[model samples]
Target chain A: MGDFLETDEKVLISLCKRGDLSAYDRLMQRYEKKVYALCFRMVGNQDDAADLAQEAFLKAFRALSSFNGQAQFSTWLYRIVTNTCLDEQRRQARRPQLLSLDKPLNTEDGQLLLTLPAEASDPLDTALSQETEAEIKTLLSMLPASQRIVLVLRDMEGYSYEEIAQILNINGGTVKSRLNRARARLRDLYLKKEELFRPTVHLNRKERRDRL
Target chain B: MSCEKFTKNMGAYLDCVLSGKELSEFQEHLSVCNTCRQEAEELQSMFSWLKQAGELTPPKDLRKSVLAELKKEQGRKGIRSFPGFSYAAPAAVVLIMLVVGNLSLLLPLHVSDAVPMRAAYQQESGTVTPPADAIIYTEDSPDNEQVSEKSELSSEVERNPSPRLLVLNLVLIPLFLFFSLRFQQNRKEAG
Candidate 1:
C-alpha cells in the first residue's frame, strides 16, 4: 500500500501483478472515467456503463499478469472494456426484450429547422446540447454490435485506426471498413429520424446562418 | 473513381489516408457527383459531432462500488483458492467402507479364493464342498475348522478386497475436482 501518487503506470501495473491492490486502485483511478465513457457510449446509459466498467477493471486486474506491456496499458485496458461491453450487448441480444420503439426522440425539430445561429457560440456547446448528445447515444445504441463498436471506438472514443484494430483484434483494413460501415449505418439511422441532425454541426463561424 | 469505388474509399478519403493520385480521383468524383459529395459531408459532420459529444465524468462512488465489488469477488475466489476446497458438494457419494482388514485375524481364518461370496451356502448337512483355492493364512487356532456357512465366507471376502482401487479413486477425485473447476473458471473468463 505504498503511496502511488507519483508512480508510473508500468510500475503500478507491476505492483498490481505482485499483489498490491492499492496499486491496481491507482491504475484504476487513472482510467475509470475513460472506461466509463466508453461503456456509456457503447450502452447509452449510466447504470449499465458503470457495471460494465467495473467488470472490465476486474478483468484487467485478473488478466494483469498476461499484460506484457507490448501494448500501452491504456490500450490493453480499453480492449478489455470494449470486449466486456460487446459481450454484454451480445448477452442482452440473446434474451431479446420488448423495445420501446416509439420512445420520443430528444430532437424535437425536423430538418427544416436546421440553421447556423447568427452569433456563433462555443461550437461544442451548441453541437452537443444535452438532447443532441442523448440523441447521439441512443442512435449509437441502435447500431449492430460489430458496427457500433468500431464506430464508438473511432468516433467517440478517439482511438486510432491501428489502435482500434488492435483493440477489436481485427486488422487495420478491417477496422477501416467496419468503421466506414458503422458511420454509414449511423448516417442512415440519423437520416431515418431526419430531425437528429443538429443545426450546429456544420456551422463553423460562417454562413448558412438561417433556414432558407 | 466509380461512385461505388468512391463510396468504398470514403473512409480512407475522410481519414486522409488516400495517396495523391487516389485523392485527386476521389476529389474529382466528389466535384462532379453531388450525391457522393453530400454523403461525404454528412458523414464527416456526423462523425465529428459524435466525437465532440465528449467524455462524461463517472459518478463519484463508481470507484468505491467497483472496489467493493472487487472485494466481494475476491472473497468468493479466495475461499475456492484456499488450502482446501470445502463445501457440501454435489454428486456427493458417502462411501462408508468399513475397514475389515485387521479384523480378519479375529475370525476363524477361512480364506476363500476364486469363488464369489455366494458359495459355502450348502443347504444339505455334511455335504459341504471346500472352495478349491481356500488357503489358511493365519495359524492361530489348533483346529482349523473348514468353515461351512455363507456368512463366514462373505465376511471373509469383504476383509480382503483390493485396497488400491478405493484409495486411488478417493485420493484422485477431490484433486481432480479442484483443478478442473479452476481450469474451467480460467477458461470461462480468460483474456
Candidate 2:
C-alpha cells in the first residue's frame, strides 16, 4: 500500500491509453500479483485467479482510453478485476455439477494431494483440506456477487472503504455495512469448524497473555 | 446497550467510521460490554491475518491468451470494414433510383400532338384517313382530348411494358443480389 503511490499510476495510465505496451506491461507487473492474490483468496485456486487476472488486465487495457482522472488508476483496475471475478463466479454457480479442482501432479501442492496416487497414505485429510478450500470457495461463491466483490476488494485486497465504494458504484456507507456483514459471515463460517474454532480459543488466550 | 445496537456500531467503529460524539458514545458502550469488545477484537485479528496471506502471481500464459483474443477481435473488425461491403449499400440505392427514374420518364404523349400529327401525315401525303377502329377511344373537349391521349399512351405502356425497362430490371436485380450476397459473405467471414 505504501509503495503503490510511488509508481505514478496516472502516468502509467496515460501511457497505456497511448498504446504503449511496455508501459502497460509495467503497470501489469506492478499490480498483477496483488490482483491475482485477491482473486485466489476469493476464488481459492491458482488457475481461476490467473484467468480472472488476465481478464481484468485486458478489460482495463480496453477501457483505459475512457478513464476519467477522477479516481486512481489502481482503483479503476480494481473495479475491472472485481467485476471480472464476479462474472466468473456467477457463471460457475449456474452449473450444477461440482467443478474439478484437479491439478497436475508436478506442482508441490498437487504432489502432496494427488488422490489417486499410490504413495499417499493420509490422502483423506489432504482431500478434506482441498474440500475445505472448495467449501470456503463455494460459500464465497454463494454471496451476492456484488457484496462478495466489496468484501474481496476491501477485506482481501486491503483496498480502502472509499475505493471499494467507488469501484462498486455504491456509497461509502453501503461499502462499510456490506464489508462488516461479509466479515461477520466469514467469521461465523470459520467458527463452525471445531478444529479452527478450538484453535481460536487457544490463540485468543495466547494473544491476551502476550498483550499483558 | 442492546446487543443489536452494539453490533451495528461495532462494524462502523472498527473501520474508524464513527464521528464526533458517536465515537465517544461507542467507546463508552464498548468499555461496558465485554462481549462486544471481544467480538470486535476477533474481527480485527481475522482481517489482519487475512491481509498477511502472501501475494500470489498468475501463470505466465494468461496475458498471451488475452492478447491473442484481442487480436482476433481486431481482425474481425477489419473484415467488417472491407471496402466492397461498405460500398454495397450506396451502390444498391443508386442502382434502384436509376431504374425508377428511367421508368418514370416513359409517360403518355399529348392527344394534341398525336391527332394533329396523324392528320397532317394523312393530308400532306394524300393518304386515306385512319379507320374508326384505328381510333379506339376519343376525348370530348380539346383539352380533355389531349389529356385522354396522354393517359391512353401511359395505359398502353402499362399494357405492354418496355424492353428498356426490362433490361434495367435485369441489370439491377442481379446487382442487388450480388450486393446482398456479398454482405452476407462478409458477415460470415467476420464471424
RMSD of 2: 13.0
> What digit string (tens of lDDT, one per residue) describes model 1 on residues A1-212?
33444347778889988767777787888898899988988887677888888888888888888999888777888889989998998898789565332133233332223332232224665444665665676678768888988887777777789889888888988998888888898898777655544433343233445543
DockQ score of each predicted structure, in the order shown? 0.33, 0.22
Candidate number achieving the greatest DockQ relative to the actual structure: 1
Which ranges in model 2 have alpha carbons more than 4 Å from their true place?
A1-11, A95-139, A195-212, B17-20, B75-191
- Evaluated with TM-score, which candidate comes out highest? 1
lDDT string, candidate 1, B90-126, tens digits: 2233222223422343343344442434443443223
Regions of model 1 farther than 4 Å from truth: A1-7, A101-128, A195-212, B52-54, B73-191
The local distance difference test score of each candidate is 0.69, 0.65
Question: Could you give me the TM-score of model 2 versus the true structure?
Answer: 0.60
Give the count of colliding residue pairs in each prediction.
0, 0
Q: Residues A15-117, candidate 2, lDDT per residue (tens digit)?
A: 8787666677778887777788767766766767887888788888878777997787777887788778878877977887553433212332222222221
- The collision pairs in model 2 are none
Docking class of 2: incorrect
